[model samples]
Target: MLSTEADSHANQSDDYAVAPARAWFAFVMIFLLMLSDYIDRQIVVSLFPHLKEEWGLSDKQLGALVSVISVVVAVGSLPVAMMADRFGRVKSIVVMASVWSMATIACVFARNYSQLFAARAVVGLGETGYGAAGSALVNGLFPKRWHSTLLGAFFAASAQGAVLGVILGGVIADHWGWRAAFGAVGFPGLMMALLFMLVPDYKNVVVRFAPKVQSKSPKAFVKRLYAALTHGPTLLWVCLAGAFELILVSTIWAWMPSFFNRFHGMDVTDAAKHAALVVLCCAVGALFWGWVADRLSQRSPRNKLLAMCVLTLLTFAVFTYAFTAHLEVSTQYALILLGSFLMTCSVGVTTSTVLNVTHPGLRATGSAVLALFQNLFGLAVGPLFGGIISDAWGLDVALAAIPSIAILSAICFWKASRSYEADMALVAAVLRQEAAGERVENTAVLPPLTAAQA
Candidate 1:
């Protein structure tokens, strides 16, 4: 099946000239750094109890540690992605990894809650535009057909790192201390940062500017951003769908340990490990469904959004029932695992959807806009609100409420499906413009493509 699918994209052209061996090697390098990225980001979740116990902190404060990173990533990603153009993606990523890794290590020396929170924010700052830079580099290096699958692979790395972080944080904290857990995960990212420099960088896109445009002007940049942000109905709808789905996914990732510990009567380490195991299922599901969505899209491009919508509905059904029914603990865990799997159905495909409709020069910025929505509205909201609601009412209410967004997510994807073909036409015309040696400058803000031109 995989071989057959590989044959489908055999005609897709790669923009970069990386050797096959070198390309795969570069993927391995980037994949590891992405893994390291989440491990550092999520390791603190398993230490929430420790922080709460030691500092006598509120749940909101503990949740703030996780939410702050997403908030920072949301606000900083646009500017940070711009840096990838200036510094080069490979070099920028190396610097990003180094900063985040060092910040993670600095957590070990934090004496108060303020100090620790400051370090986590630094970690967020370092991670700001990594997805945008990394995705753009990977997209250019691989065939067009491979873009969505590779993106799925990238996000699978995120789930993989998260699982490891949650498990390691609990185990190390139990045996050594919470601080040691930080050191253990922190040091490896530094090593990975140095190694990431060995990966090849993609060639930059150089285009003649339109007479009215200034390449280096802040006004030019904002226009470019505005174009990407409001490119078409498909990109807008797809971005919203991905953001809504993350409400459930991030809430689960952030609160899984506490949920297991409280409801299942498990110890902190045991609960973290259990939650990590559930998240490992999430990684598997993301990769598997991503492959399925890709194959479905081969028959019809619109099938991708349809696939996402179906999976999201499945998530809502499973989660709503599991939380509301008086089921056994084992049964509940089983349902939650399935829910986790289905919740991220849109993750990779949505980014790919944005890429398909966006100008190649603005692909990184395009993905960052999705990141902006996902972080600010989805990831940032999930943990903070979960903690607040849990404090105000109960954890179960927060958990159950999060999955309802899946309904809205499905609706958005369905709406996006209607506009997919029209949006792809515009992108196709833009690609033709590039091929014809005509600069399609700021096409995002320009008039729609006619059927004849497309």
Candidate 2:
């Protein structure tokens, strides 16, 4: 049992009951920061041509520039998230945004490839816990009813930001230089970080899972974290299912432009735009499924698992045929668009599910754990595996083969469905106990930590 909301919000008051306007402001700022985070991360993709021309780099080296960020972010997320949980998300975000933004701006002065690569790694480090912390912030601020929908919108920002990054990077580079692209995207993030300071901080929830005497101890904290993360079947399966879903998403998004160029005879630019359109469709699907999931789960929390299961099945069916049926180019692209939408059904669902069962005090850390799985197992594996398959059997075969992963993801959701209700109920009880305990303490002679009071 670990959760505490605002003083104004009673134990059962939807956290939004107090200062709803402030919650909206916080969400808006966090949304901008999320957009800026991905934009900085992805803007480099569009600069590949510029880098290759200026430095005479190979494709492999150019690719590493992007891959390194994912690796660093995957590795760094947990520790940063732990610190965020202990401190405050707003302050941590301010520091992270400043570091990453300055690092991105620093790329403009890079002397060579190594310098640029190092700067990108710093960007990853800064971004490590942002998603986790942001998700926690928004989820805690809103009530359970809005969790799926708002989280859906929050997650959609990543796809939207990536699209903006590519388009803005290319456009800015064409007008100015590749260096200017980094500066353009990075500066706005720094300014947004400054504005974020105005958002109020949620009252820090101490770890109720630990004994009060040992609550702040590092060893106790780690043990409690491990227990929370590994305690239930829901978190484990949902994480794996989400990772598998991303394999489908990342494979298509990374290689589809080349797939079209190679198989359908579309030019590079048109093919890229074509892929972007599919991702935009995914963005839409995330919101739609979020709504659907909320409606289905009104009776029981576990119904959300069924939504993800159906979504993955739909993705598998659509992608398998689109890639293998030998259809017309237009027909295939249409199916790919549908597949894209279907694959994103778990975006908000996965994170919201994680938060639902997690101790509210550990919400941000729980999100980081999910982020770790997604970045390391899902995002990292998808594009690389697709490339490996492309090298052997060709792009069409690779894309067609990847849909089989959706079957595995669907299986995971069904397995998760078994225990989700139990796990969610368990955590809700814990939250209620902790919330009531706080009320008792506050009523009983609580005192401030000050020399004068002592």
**Among all candidates shown, the one with the greatest lDDT:** 1
Q: Using TM-score, give the best candidate's number.
A: 1
Colliding residue pairs in candidate 1: none
Decoy 1 TM-score against native: 0.91
Model 2, residue 204: distance off in Å is 2.2
On residues 1-454, what C-alpha lDDT tens digit does candidate 1 reach at each position? 0000011112136543477889889999988998999999999999988888999988788889999999999999877876675557888899999999999999999999999999999999999999888887777678877888888888889999999999999999999999999999999999999988889876554322234443445665555455533447788788789888888888899998988888888889999999998889889888888788889998999999998888999999999999999999989989988888877667789888887776665666677888888898888888888899889988899888878989999999999999897888876776666556564432322332223322
TM-score of 2: 0.86
What lDDT does model 2 reach? 0.76
- Candidate 1: list runs displaced more than 4 Å: 1-16, 207-224, 228-231, 440-454
Least well predicted 10-residue stretch by lDDT in candidate 1: 1-10
How do the residues 175-292 of candidate 2 rate in per-residue lDDT, one tens digit apiece? 8988998999888999998888997767654553423332445665555555654346788888898888887776665566556656777654555567667768877888889888
lDDT of each: 0.81, 0.76
